[model samples]
Target: MFPFPPSLPPVATESAEDLAEQSEIEYGTLEGGSTMAFFRDSKIETYQKMWRYMESKRPSVFVPTIEEGVKRVLEGNYAFLMESTMLDYTIQRNCNLTQVGGLLNSNSYGIATPIGSPWRDKISLAILELQEKGIIQMLYSKWWKNTGDVCNRDEKNKDSKANALGVENIG
Candidate 1:
C-alpha cells in the first residue's frame, strides 16, 4: 500500500516539511496521502506547528483524541505526533510501532500533590529514594519493555478489578 521509497519517508533523514511534501506528492490528499495526526486537545506550542502542517494537505484528517489518533496511525497512512513520554510508552508496549524521528520539543513532568497537602514532600522524597535505588527504571522496563505478549492490553478483558489513577481512587 505504501508507494513511497523502500524506507519510510519519516525517517530521521529528512525535515518534517520534506516528509509531508513527499507524501503529499506520492499519495495525493484524496487517496489517503501520508499525513501527520495529533491529539486535538493538546495546547502545546510545537504541536501547533504540526497542526499547521496537517492543515496544508487536509485539515479534516486530524483525530480528536489520543486513543483515536493512535488507532488511526495503526490503520495506516497516518503518523500520530504525541508527547514523548506517552508515545515512548505506547511504542514500547506495541511491537508494531516505531518512532520515526527525534522529539520536536521536550517537557518535564513532576509528581503533583495539591497545594498544602501533607503528602507533597513525602511523595517527593519517596520518589527520590526509589530513583536512588533504581526501582523507577526497573519498573519502567518491567511495564513498558518486558510486558510484551505476557500482558493483556485490553482493559475490559482484565480478570482483576482496576482502580483509576488518582489518590482519591486508592483503596
Candidate 2:
C-alpha cells in the first residue's frame, strides 16, 4: 500500500453542508439547485471514474516547462478534453480574465511543454497583460524591478483596489 506523500498538504475538514456549497460554487449552480440531482443521476459517476483514470499519473512525467504545458494542453487529446470542460464551465459562469489567469497558472502542469510559435505569441501577450496588471511578478532576474513596475501598473488597473487590499487579496 502507498503511504500518503509528505509533500501533500493536510486535507481540510468540511461539513456536508459546506461541501455542498463548495460544489455548487465550483459548478456554477444556484444553492439547492437541481445540479446536485444531476450528479446523482449516474453520468457523474462515470465522469468521476474517467477523471480518476486520467489523473492517475503525474503530467510532469511527460512535459517539463510552462511552454510545454501550453503545447500539450492545446494539442493533446486528454488535455483538450479537460480544457474544453473547464472552458465551458468558465463561459457558463461568465468568469473574467483573472479567473482564466488563475486556471492557466494552476493547470500549467497539465500542458507544460515546448509551445508552438503562434500559441507562444498569444501566451506572450497574455503574460504581458498579466504582468502589467501585477498579477504575476518576475524574480531572480536583472530586469525584475522594471518588469515589476510595468506589471504593477497593469495590476492596478485590472484590480481597482489591489494596492489598498493588502497581502490577503493575492490569488
Candidate 3:
C-alpha cells in the first residue's frame, strides 16, 4: 500500500498532447522511442493509437501490468498510458504517482457476456434496474468516492486563482 495525497489537485490531468510533449522532453529525446507502459494485448483502440503515435517517433516499451507501469513511472523518465479508471485508482493508492494529462478518449464500463448467451438480456436488465434504483451509483460512491482513504480536493476557488509562475507551469 502507498500513502495517499493530503489534498487532491483540481484537475486530474492536462491535455494529452501536453503530457506527451512533456514526457518526451523528460526522457531526453522525442525521436527515440521512450518507454511507456500499457496493458499487454489491450483491446482498447486508444492503446493502439498511442502505440502507433509513439512508435512513429520512437519505439515504446510496453509492459504487462499497471504495477509495472507505476514502477517505471516512479523510477522516473517514463509515462504510463492507461484507462482513466486505472489511472485514478493507482493515483489514489500512491502519493508519488499522479495523472499527467486529460483523457485521450472516453469509454463506458460494461458487463461482458458470451455472444448469444441467454443470460445476457437478464444480466443487462438487472444492471439497468440497479442503475435506475440508484444501487449502482451508491456502490460506485461507496467504493470510489466515500472510501475515506482517497484524498479530497477543495474546488471552491479552482477557477478564480491566478496561475502560479513556475518553470514547470510555463511549459
Q: Pick the candidate with the highest lDDT.
A: 3
Model 1 pairs whose backbones collide: none
Lowest summed lDDT across 10 adjacent residues in model 3 is found at: 26-35
lDDT of 1 by residue, 1-171 (tens): 111221343442233334444443221112231223232333544345445555665645555565666666666666665566666666655545555545444456698778999999999899999999999999978887677553343446332222122332122
In model 2, how large is the Cα lDDT of residue 31? Answer: 21
The numbered model that scores best in TM-score is 3
- 127: Cα error in model 2, Å: 28
lDDT of 2 by residue, 75-102 (tens): 3221222232333332233212112212
Candidates, ranked, TM-score: 3, 1, 2
- TM-score versus the correct structure, for each prediction: 0.57, 0.19, 0.57
The local distance difference test score of each candidate is 0.49, 0.30, 0.50
lDDT of 3 by residue, 1-171 (tens): 111122323322244333333434221112221224331233444445555565664544455556665676676555555666666666765656555544444457778889999999999899999999999889977887678787554447453221332333232
What C-alpha lDDT, on a 0 to 100 scale, does residue 153 get in candidate 1? 38
Cα deviation of 129, candidate 1, in Å: 1.3
In model 3, which residue pairs have backbone atoms overlapping below 3 Å? 14-101, 14-102, 33-58, 33-59
